[model samples]
Every structure is written in C-alpha cells, then in structure tokens.
Target: MNIDIVCVGRIKERYLTDAIAEYSKRLSRYCKLDIIEVADEKTPEHASAGVDRQIKAKEGERIAKHLKDGAFVIALAINGKQLSSEELAAKINDLGLRGTSHIQLVIGGSIGLDEAVLKRADYKLSFSKMTFPHQLMRVILLEQIYRAYKINAHEPYHK
Candidate 1:
C-alpha cells in the first residue's frame, strides 16, 4: 500500500522533523510513505470570517493538487469520527483487503480545512475534540499510522 500525508506548510522545528523521520523509517517496512507540504497563507490579526475562508480555500487548492486519482482520502477534522488504535488498524487492513492501493491523509493549516476538501474526503478522522498545532499533528498522525500497521501485522511494537 501507498500512504501519503498531504499537509499545509513546512515543519521548521528540528525535533518534530526528527520524529517524522523516525516514524517514516519504521513505516518503510509496511508501505511506501510520502509527506507533501504546501504553502500556507499568513493570517492577519482580527481577520474576518471571509478572510479565513479565503486562506483555507487557497491552502485547499494546493492540497487538491497532490491528491491522486483512486486514492482513498482521510481528512483530519475535529468533528470527524473518533476511532481507537485497533479500529484504525482494522480500517487500514480492510481498505487494503478491498484493493485500495493508495491512501491520502490530509492535515489542514492552522485555520483548518475548507468545505470542499472535507467534502472530497472518503473519511474524516478525529484524534480529539481539542485542537493541536498542525506541525505537531503531523508527527502524531505518523505515529498512529505506524501503530496501526504494527497492530495489523500482529507485531510487538503496538502494545
């Protein structure tokens, strides 16, 4: 299986970059992994709702470019369904069993994803009701995916 994490903006912190690298290495045995970064727009202080929408839309456009045809998309959203690690593992296994060759998981910018991107998603996943920094979320998402793979393979890493 091929897994792609399409996100907004570059990761500047060294520790987070290192964590991503570690998870990517662990995931190499499970599937091909790609982390794609898109440009993020600067939000003005006290911006209006319309301005926020515009920023998300611009970021959404960049995200849409990397989405592959026939790839199942799972967008991260606060309002999305919450699943346990085992459930996520089952979901991944089922997708693979059903012949899904590629999966794209999207993490939005600080302002969040646009309606269009959410609508295009085959699934929406939520880690928690609380918000997280987009950069940190990337690392967390990678770890969860690695756990899912380990669980699916009956590996000892997922304890």
Candidate 2:
C-alpha cells in the first residue's frame, strides 16, 4: 500500500525530523510511506474565529489536493476513534483486502481540521484526548504505523 501523511506545518526541529524519517525508513519494509507537509495558514491578530477557521479550511484544501483519487482518507481528530496497534494493523490489512491501494492520513494544525476535510475522511482517528503539538503528533503517528506493521508481521517490536 502507498500511505501518505498529509500534515500542516514543516517540522522545524531536527530531532523530530530525524525521528520521523527513521520510522519512515522502517515502514518501507511494509509499505510505501510519504510525508507531505502543507503550509500553515497565518491568522492576523485581529482575526475573528470565523476567519481563523476559513484559513484552516484553505490549508485543508491544499492538503486534500494531494490525495489520490479513490484513496482512503483518514483524518486525525480529537473526537475520533482510538485503536490499539494490533487493531490498526488489522484495519490496514482489511483495507488492503478491500483493494485500497492508497491511504491518506491528514493531520491538522493547532486550531484543528476544517469540517469539510473531516467529512471527506473514510476514517477519523484520535491518538489521545489530550492535545499534542503538531510536530510531536507526526512522530507519534509514524511510530504507531511502524508498530502496527510489526504487529501485523508478528514481529518482536510489538511485544
């Protein structure tokens, strides 16, 4: 499967980048993983909440454009379903069986994702109820994906 992580904002921290890259390399043994970073929308000091939401929506649109046609879209949201590593692997395998060749994972900015993007997602996933920084979330998501692959293969990493 070809999995793409579409996230907002560039990872500025070298450590975070290195960690994400390491997991990406590890994931290559299972499937193709691509991480795409979209520019975060800037909100002015006097911007209203509605304006801020619109900015986020525009950013979401940019991310959505990269999604392949018929790709399974999964959005990361606070109110989404939480799955264990084993369950995630099962889900991935199920998708593969369903003939889904591409999986797009969307990660929003601090303000969260636009409603349109959420509505477009085939699945909505939440890592935790407590919010995390976008950069940290990227690392966590990648690690989980790698763990899921390990669990699917009955590898020792999941133990």
Candidate 3:
C-alpha cells in the first residue's frame, strides 16, 4: 500500500524537515510514502470569521485535487479518532487486505481543516486533543506511520 501525506504549508524548519524525511525513508521499506505540500492561504488583518472559513475551504479544495481517485482519504483533526500504534497497524493491514491502493493523509493549516474536507475523508484521526502546528504534525504523522509499519512487520524500531 502507498501512503501520501498532504499538508497545507511547507516545512520551513530544517530540523522538522529532516525528521520527517528520516521517517519517510524508514517507512519506504514497507510502502511508498510521499509528502505533498500545498500553498497556505494568507489571512489579512481583521479578516472576518466567514472570510477565514472561505479561504480554508479553498485550500481544502486544492488538497482534494491532489488526491487520487478511489484512494482512501484520512484527515487529521482535533475531534477525530485516536488510535494506538498497534491499532493503526491493524487498520493499515485491513486496508491492504481490502485492496486499498493508496491512502491519503491530510493536514490542514493553522485554522484547521475545512468542513468539506472532513466530510470527504474516509477516516478522521486525531493524535491529541492539544493542537499542534501543521509542520510538527507532519513529522509526528510520519513517525507514527513508520512505527505502525514496524509493528506490523514485528520489527524492533517501534519500541
């Protein structure tokens, strides 16, 4: 199975990028892992809540375009399901057995994901109730994915 992480903003921090890349490399042994960065919307001063939602909605559309047809989409949200590493591995294995060719994991920007994107996702996952920056979330997601693969393969890296 192939996994793709689609995030709204670029990772500017070198350390964060390096960390994500390292996990990506480790996950490649199990499945193809790719990170896709989308342009973030610029919010002007005194922007209304409605305006902000519109901008986030547009960004969500751009993310939707990158998704492959028939791929299972998973959106990272604060209110989503929180799964353990072992559970995540089982979910991945279940998807694989179900013949899911691609899995798209989406990370929204500062304001969070649009309602449309969340509605479209096959699964909504939450790492924690406390909010995280989008850049850091990418790295965390990558690490979790790597750990999941390790668990699935009975490897020692997950410990």
Candidate 4:
C-alpha cells in the first residue's frame, strides 16, 4: 500500500517536523509514505464567511491537484466519522484487499476543506470534535496511520 498525506501549508516548527519525521520513518516498514504540502492561502484576521469560503476554495484547488483519481481519498473534517485505531487498520486492510493501491489523507488549511474537495472524498475522518492546528494535525495523523499498520499486523502497540 502507498500512503500519502496531502496537506495545506508547510510545517515550520521544528518539534512538529521532528515528530512527523519519526512517524514517517516507522511507517516506511509497512508501506511507502509520502508527505505532500500545498501552499495555503493567507486569511484576514476579521474575514467574513464569504472570504473564508474563498480561502478554503483556493487551498482546495492546490490540494485537488495532488489527488489522483485511482487513489482512495479520506479528508479530515470536524463533522466526519470518528473511528478507533483498530477500525482504521481494518479499513486500510480492506482497501488493500479490494485492490486500492493508493490512499490519500487530506488535512485542510486554517479554515477547512472546500465543498468540492469534500465531495471527491471516499471517506471523511475526524480525530476529535475540537479544532486542532493544521500543522500539529500532520503529526497526529501520521502516528495514527503507523498505529493502524501495527494493529493490522497483530503487533503490540501502546494503547
């Protein structure tokens, strides 16, 4: 299986980048892992709803460019379904069994994902209802994916 994390903006923080690098190395044993960063749109401090929508749309366009038609897409959203680590492992396993070779997990910019990008997703996943910084989300997502692989292999992992 090939796993791709397609997210908006770059990780400028050293600690977050270190965490991401650590998980990426661990994931290398299970599958080929790729982290693709798209340019994020700058949002005004006091933007209206329409302005926010436009920002998301601009970021979505950049994200959409990286999404391959053959790849299974799972976009992260606040209202998305929340699943356990085991369930996520099962989902990945099942997708591979069904011949899905590529999986793209999307993390949106500061605002969120656009309607068009959400519509294109095969699945929408949520880590929590509370909003998280998109930069930190990259690390969290990588760790969960690595845990999923460990679970699928029936290997012991920290609960």
Candidate 3 stretches greater than 4 Å from native: none
Q: What lDDT tens digits, residue by residue, belong to model 1 across residues 62-127?
A: 999998889999999999999999999999999999999999999999999999999999999999
Q: Check candidate 3 and list the clashing pairs.
A: none
Q: Candidate 4 lDDT, tens digit per residue, 6-48? A: 9999999999999999999999999999999999998999999
Against the true structure, candidate 2 reaches a TM-score of 0.95
Score residue 32 of candidate 3 by CA lDDT: 87
Instruction: Sort all candidates by lDDT, best to worst.
Output: 1, 4, 2, 3
- In model 3, state the lDDT of residue 7: 93
TM-score per candidate: 0.99, 0.95, 0.95, 0.98
Q: Between 1 and 2, whose lDDT is larger?
A: 1
Estimate every model's Cα lDDT from 0 to 1: 0.97, 0.91, 0.90, 0.95
Over the full model, what C-alpha lDDT does candidate 3 score relative to the true structure?
Answer: 0.90
Please estimate how well model 1 matches the true structure, expressed as its whole-model Cα lDDT: 0.97
In the range 1-159, model 2's lDDT, one tens digit per residue, is 999999999998999989998999999999998899899987688888899889988998988788777899999999999998888989998999999989999999878898889999999999999999988999999999899888878889886
Rank by TM-score, highest first: 1, 4, 3, 2
Query: After superposing candidate 2, which stretches have Cα over 4 Å from the reference?
Result: 44-47
User: Can you list the residue pairs that collide in candidate 4?
Assistant: none
Look at candidate 3 and tell me the lDDT of residue 39. Answer: 93
Q: Write the per-residue lDDT of candidate 3 for residues 40-157, one digit (tens) a residue.
A: 9987888899989998998999898998779999999999999998999899889999999799999998889989899999999999999998899998898888888889889898
Highest TM-score model number: 1
